[model samples]
Target: MIERPIGRDVVARQRFARLFSLGDRRAPLSWSPGLVLGPDDPELPVSVAPLRSTRSYDSIPATITICPRDNLCYPFDSEDKWVAQEGLVLPPSLVASDSGMFGSGLEAVPVSWNSLHHDDSLAVLDSEPSVIILIDAPQLAQRPGMLAEALLTVRTRFPSSLIWAPGISGPDNCALLTWMGVDLFDLARLRHASSLGVLLTGSGPRKVEETVNEDFGMEAQCTTWVQAISSTRAAIREGTLRELV
Candidate 1:
């Protein structure tokens, strides 16, 4: 169970608090009463239990932030495939353009990614999200200007919901994200780098130093990653997520 930090007003912290509360209740996440998938949607198979399914409004705070396809593997029409691959479908109205799919209520919060390119359509995207997900697809992630534009939009409307920037692997990128006030981050690119024989080491877990494969053996990456996550959870518990970065 991960303990949550009290001060940050981001949805990630909310979800962590929910998970932590469940842990305190000694509740098995799988057995928790909550929406798993849509009533009619097919369930997918995966080792890691689905995140949204395990969340319960009754047990914890209701707001949730999600970048449905963080890796951008799904097509615009691949919503079902995306859910199936991820093990559970979320509320249908999130992806549906038509009305009455699922009326807006306390169901859940849906957040989407900003395509790395500063596409002109971003203005339209501004209406929906309480929070917008800004990805640091540095090499292939969204460019800086696009991120700035989106952040500007977010600052205008739903300033309460935060910008979650992922794939930040360096001090420069971290500095930029921090300056942007990015509330949440995940080490996905580091995992991608590891899969490609590139090693990530740095002052912060999210900040990558170099490809240090010689000193840190290939097999050790998994163990080191576990330790890193453990350390990160501990730091967050102690109110030092921002400090570590």
Candidate 2:
């Protein structure tokens, strides 16, 4: 197998809509912006046994694993302050990222739109990273319009690297964000809502009522995710996602 570097490649495009594959070529993760992870989506999981954990994940097909604090100077935990996770066997597509405000706690450097107005942004701008994780996505979503503007700004700034806004989206705003250009999202929000007895839908979150025979099991949650992601992907391809907005 050829050893491809950690990177993202655009396989298809429709205006700002993007269809890209990223991570190691061995098990590349592919998607278009506004793609949200459900319970069973392949993921970039961060954990205490960053190295050994990834080794175990190899048996699973097509998962993207990224080690936290891959940098020798930054450790996963204070208890393991001297340990470095760089030896973790993962898809090369995971991360060989630059340091910024987060000092390398994750596979991709953590940054926020707030940095643009401050001096700290210089470090991020200077690194010219190929990928970045948006740390304040939830906060951006809370405000009326900051999220879209920030998304546009980052797209302009990087122009090439993929952008990940983890734990901040689901059926709720996937189309809106996809329209704005977010390259990645995760199921953290969906999983959390399920645990809280809430069922999420494209329209909004609804309280799951046991009296109504509504299933709140993991399988059910995964099904919801599959439907949402599938429809959004199809919309992107059909050029009707904007119509849904």
> What's the lDDT of the predicted structure labeled candidate 1?
0.32
On a 0 to 1 TM-score scale, where does candidate 1 land against the true structure? Answer: 0.36
* Residue-wise C-alpha lDDT for candidate 2, range 1-245, written one tens digit per residue: 11112344566555566655443334443444533333354443221111111212343222333332222111212211111112222221222432222223233444555443332543455444434566567777777787777777777777665667767777777676667787665667777877888887777778777787887555565556556666666777777878766
lDDT score, candidate 1, position 45: 18
Candidate 2: list runs displaced more than 4 Å: 1-5, 23-29, 34-107, 119-130, 209-212
User: Candidate 1: where is the Cα deviation over 4 Å?
Assistant: 1-131, 135-144, 167-172, 203-245
lDDT scores in order: 0.32, 0.52
Cα lDDT of model 1 by residue, 1-245, tens digit: 21121111221332221112111123212211011222222332111112222223442223233322211111222211111011122222233332221112111232232221223344454333322433223422433355555555554554544344435533223333434444434444444555665555434333334664253233343344334443444444555555544
Displacement of the residue 149 alpha carbon in candidate 2, Å: 1.6
What is the Å distance of residue 6 in model 1 from its true position?
A: 9.8
In order of appearance, the predictions have TM-scores of 0.36, 0.63
